[model samples]
Target: MPQETFTLQIRQIRLETDDVLSFELASPTQNPLPVAPAGAHLELHLPGALQRSYSLLDEGLGGCYRIAVKREPQSRGGSAWLHSQARVGQTLQAQAPRNDFALNEHAPESILIAGGIGITPLLAMARRLNRLGHRWSLHYAAPSPDRMAYRDCLQALAADGHGSLHTYCSSEDRRLDIAAVVRASGPQAHLYCCGPAGLIDDFITATQDRPPERVHYERFAARHAASTEGGYEALLARSGKTVKVSAGRTLLDAILDAGVDIPYACSQGVCGTCRTRVISGTPDHRDECLTEAERQSNEAIIPCCSGALSSTLVLDL
Candidate 1:
């Protein structure tokens, strides 16, 4: 399936809180909005910045497209740029929606756990679940009511509907009761969570007894421990250039730093953006998007998150 990337001007920007904004992009563009399910996210190519991924909050039917973004205290510059600087009427390049967190049709009950900004994707799931009248529950954890995105709307939906929505103000409470929520779910219920790495780790631990396939997780950051040795050099066969990327930096970063552009999204590796043909070299795969066969072939790897394991890896570029 080919994705249609389009440039749209920002139609509106609503401040959800001090740092979060619910951005609305113009809908009537050259490429029409496709029908996207809950958990679908778009890859944004910020002006003069690396590609960043954001979950789609609004359904495709709306005349406008909405996405909620929270400014991170220690961001790599993407969120900070969007939160503090990106203005309405500015044009931004965005790719078509990609969904890796769709609801499990086999699941009788859906349990969503969100932490802080992680609520963006899960909120979409709640919307579809509510409309479908499915058995579902959401546990949203934030520092306070003010920090919660879409507070009034989420609360109203939860109150007026059958789905149970629970909020945990972590500033008031020491920690969210993950154990309780996991234990409360029925044996066959599906668990979907997206948040900080700590919450994800804890959730995985709590569900150790459950089947692994039933538990779906989305990580926002790189969890791999840093490499002990120095970084390796990359050889772009198609471009005929040799670039050096440090251990802390990624192959995609090095290529971009060299003024070369390649397709990429969700630098986290889940979006399969920045995927390119690996002509040669052993790649240190860190992405969660590729399948076992894809990895075994060593033909395609997500350069955004993956690095070269060999001294000199060649990419089609």
Candidate 2:
């Protein structure tokens, strides 16, 4: 099944940094969009079927949703199009906002780490925390000050006693030490990080001693390298259909080719949209969303980047 979508008009576009642009989006009819919580993301239906997800900033900004994008010349077309072609007053189709990186404003302590353009969602969390008078801090890092987005806003938030801001710019000889930061935080502090793959991996490794519930992260791209070494059968228990996953092919494509409908976004498995229940069989979990305990239970699977450890997987499609 497809998600419901609506038209959003680009009201403003501001250069946040050298490569990052902030887009302000609102309903075409000037209606207020749904109240998006901190860390929520909106899926933009771009031209050429290139759907991309961007983090919704914390502030509503008078009912308009704000998002920041960093132009990636080497990657897919989303960022490139938005940077070189998109203009204010243009309308775009978008899916309803969804959140996998929700912030816990009530936590006793919140520590946010952002690298480069990954500051999008954490900026929202900082504002919400400031408004609620909660204790929080943001550590933002970029190669240079010219590339750090939201520097003024974050500085203002800190200057007003809302929260504290710490910045690290490699060009100035200050480097962010993830392990040191993790070691310094209190054990109970709810840590959140969104950044490059190396940063996320370092954050996870540094926080391994803390309670899993207290550590959180969001990735714009999949961390795991998906393998196509399939030698299993996916049995759709409810539909009474079986799809043979042969080597050099993915189970998701095979199942979809068999005329089965499965909702998926970010085919890379960073998004948990395709998580499905497993009636039986152990899943070779590769998704970043599933916790270790869930993988051990073998009760669910993310077929987008996962496969079966067992010869047959009875899926509850």
Clashing pairs in model 1? 264-274
Q: Could you tell me which 10 consecutive residues in candidate 1 have the lowest summed lDDT?
A: 221-230
lDDT of each: 0.80, 0.86
Q: Model 2: per-residue lDDT, tens digit, 131-250? A: 899888899999999898889999999887868899999999999998998888887799999999999989989998998888999987777777578888999997899999998877
Candidate 2 Cα misplacement greater than 4 A, ranges: 59-61
The digit string of per-residue lDDT tens for model 1 on 231-288 reads 7888888778889887577787788888777877666777776678888998888777
Error of 1 at 183 (Å): 1.7
The local lDDT score (0 to 100) that residue 305 gets in candidate 2 is 88
TM-score of each: 0.84, 0.93
